[model samples]
Target: MKILITGANGLLGQKLVGLLAEKEVEIIATGKGNSRLPNPDTFTYVTMDICNANEVMETIKTHQPDVIVNTAAMTQVDQCETEKEACWDLNVNAVEHLIKASEANNAFLLHLSTDFIFDGADGPYDEEASANPLSYYGESKLAAEELLQKSNIRWAIARTVLVYGIAHDMSRSNIILWVKNSIEQGKDLKIVDDQWRTPTLAEDLAMGCWLIAEKQAEGVFNISGKDLLTPYDMAMMTCDYFQLDKSYIEKVDGSIFQQTAKRPAKTGFNINKAREILGYEPHSFEEGIKILHEQISAQ
Candidate 1:
């Protein structure tokens, strides 16, 4: 099978490229620039912007991939709140372009979405729950999902949360890097105790997405980690796993942190649909932290 992955240099995209290498599938990886990911010689690399509909369509037409996994997005929550137009262009408009290309090429689209669509008024949301996004980023993602539903195309939308892992670009911000940096610097960390989520390991999420895509699963699915915890809890687990000083970690309420975007207080998903449909069983937060520590130490 020929597969094309957008945002190939990202945390989830890089891992997906690595995981699919052993599957005997043809992989075509694309990024926004000339940066290439570490892969076998069989993998193809393309540098193009998804926002350019004509370029994206041309690339898809040339590749003629059976599946197109879109991992590209403007993921910064606070930044999206301030730059609404840019956020919509990338998150919503770019998706519309990709959907159009996928339809033209007769390829299945695997779109990566976020769990921030919930308003946090509802805890541990299931697939049947209503989406009441509190931020512009979530609103844009929801709008994109709605567009896909109305579009006449074969697709799967995976709503994941709190993804963190090593990436080609270390400059990218994630929860794991934030905690690791705080511990390495011996600085006091103030983590939000009230903001809850099922923090997913990027590796696990990548595998789940590949499974769903390969199976040609349709509609929306909530694919995230099994364990639910707050940012403070995650920091404490990281400190424990890495043998860092736990005293440096302090708890803070989410309401106190003034931000341009309003974050959901409790955004964990049930993920029962993923478990039953895709047979996906994600690792716990502790296990995820241990694996991350081992990976970092090995590097």
Candidate 2:
């Protein structure tokens, strides 16, 4: 199997590249910048920006990979709200480019989406849940999903939630990392108690994508962590895991902070379909933290 991974420098993309390379597959890792992978020789690296349609098409044509796993996107929620055009270009237009090229190349596309497609009025969303985005980031992702559906190509949407893990030269910090850092520094933290999510481990998300590609599964699937937790709950767990003082953590609602984007009150995922069909099993939030801690310690 030949696989082309976009955003290969990203958290999930890196995980996919690492895991898929171990399988009987030829991996082509593409991203906008230079590769940050441990050893560049592990896989073929191509500098292709998802936002550039010409570049995307050229890369797809050149590789002609069997599967195109697109993980590139403007994922910052507040940034997306402020820079709506950039968000749409990356999340929507870039996906359209991939869809067109994938169809031409006859490559199955396993695209990563977010649980934010829901309005969060009701949580733990399944594959059948209607998309009602509360923020621009969600709107962009939902639009991208629509593009895939409208296309005439074999595609699968793996909707994940609150993906957290260690990565190779990660630009952004996840909730677990942030909480652990704050606790380690003895900094006072005010975590939101209102928002709920089934925070996914990055490795689990990568595995879910690989399963979809390997099984040639189509349509939508909710791929996320099993436990539903609020940010406060995760913070407490991080504190517990690191043996740090939890007294510095304060539980607060969404109203305490003034942000650019409106957050969904609750947007966890119901991943029973993934479990039943793909035989997907995800780590618990605590287990994920433990894994991250181990990885950090080893480094």
Q: Could you say which candidate leads in lDDT? A: 2
Give candidate 1 misplaced runs (Cα > 4 Å).
none
**Residue 217, candidate 1: how far off, in angstroms?**
0.6
Judge candidate 1 against the unseen true structure and give its global Cα lDDT, from 0 to 1.
Answer: 0.87
Candidate 2 C-alpha lDDT tens digits along 139-245: 99999999999899999999999888888775668888898787778799998999999999999999999999999899999999999999999988888888889
**TM-score of each candidate?**
0.96, 0.98
Backbone clashes (count) for model 2: 0
